[model samples]
Target: MLPKSILEHTLVLDIETVSAAASYAELSPTMQKLWALKAEALQRRLAEEEKMTAADYYPEKAGIYAEFGKIVCITVGVFTKNEEGQYKLRLKSFYGDDEKVLLQDFSAMLSKYFQRRGQQYVCGHNIKEFDMPYICRRMIVQGLPLPAPLQIYGKKPWELHHFLDSMTLWKFGDYKAYTSLKLLCGLFGIPTPKDDIDGSQVGRSYWEDGDLDRIEVYCKKDVFATAQVLLRFMLEDPLALIFESADG
Candidate 1:
């Protein structure tokens, strides 16, 4: 179980990403060539399991690769104690069509607020393998400085106290099996966040539907679910609650 102090210091987060371009045809000539190379490599691995061409898979799979995608939304949540000693999560999202602007805003929030609290942690589901690295790579591509919590280059495994992953925690050193956050939430009786839109549909929602607002709401739900999952791991009662903005 996580210590109470650590729970207070943790920042729960979730991100929504999509291919940098709406369609492969919209990419620059140089980027199109690069994607072709990436697609070739992926096709080799997936040849036996599926019979789809690179172009067919690009829209669905490209967003998972940081080099080929951009983050459209980032939702961050913090746990706060009320006078009654109950914990409530407050969430904020930074999102827009401009990837650079949103990334800059997220970085600024981390540097100015969370970084000031020494040894503060950022927690998420499958973040170590996906979200954290994706954010770091995109920041580098956009010429943004790496946030303090994300600068894990030279640190040993034992020294990585500032990064927490729900999937890794569940693994408990057994790395053979993979689990999804939705499955875990169901197991723990927490509401699944995928009821509206799963990760697979994010790219289409952004590019075709042009509904960033829908994407933002979905991202926030993910953040809430992730936080509740962490609470369960910490042996605390997971609250199946959603907080809305004052304007909403």
Candidate 2:
């Protein structure tokens, strides 16, 4: 179980990403060739399955890879103590059509708030594997400096105290099995964040519908759900807590 002190200082976050371009045809010639190679490699792994062209798979699967995609929205939640001494999560989102601008905004927010505090942690489901690395890579791709907490290059595994992952906690040192946030939410009786859209549809939503709002809402819900999952891990009653938008 997480200590109350650690829980209070944690910031839960989720990010939504999409392909750098709306379609394969929109990619630069160099990127198109790279993607073709990537797709070919992926297809080779699925040789037993029905074959589909690389272009057909690019829109749906490319965003999960940071090298081939860009972040569209990053929704963050913080657990704040109430007057009653209970904690509630407050959420904020940084999002835009311009990846560099959004990343700059997010990096600035981290430097201003989270980085100055020594023990503050950034928490999310599967963050150690996906979200954290993706953020770091995209920041580099955009030529932004890595925030202090994110600069985990030479730190030994035992020294990473400022990064919390609900999935890692659930593993309890058993690293073989994987768990999805939605699946854990279901198991713990928390609301799943996929009612409207799942990660698989994010690329389509951004490229086809131009709906950053929808993606932001979905990302925010995941942030909330991740916080609730962490609360559950701490043996707290997740249902008793409520999250409010920081804007409101």
> Model 2's lDDT to the true fold?
0.88
Q: Give all candidates' CA lDDT scores.
A: 0.86, 0.88
Model 1 pairs whose backbones collide: none
Which one is best on lDDT? 2
For model 2, the stretches where C-alpha displacement exceeds 4 angstroms are 116-118
Clashes of 1: 0
lDDT of 1 by residue, 1-248 (tens): 77768877888989999998888888888988888888878778665768466567779789999999999999999888777777788889999999899999899889887774346888999988899889999999999998777787877767776778999999999999999999999999998999999999999999999999999999988988988888888788887344544213
In order of appearance, the predictions have TM-scores of 0.93, 0.96
Please estimate how well model 1 matches the true structure, expressed as its whole-model Cα lDDT: 0.86
Q: Write the per-residue lDDT of candidate 2 for residues 214-236, one digit (tens) a residue.
A: 99999999999999888888888
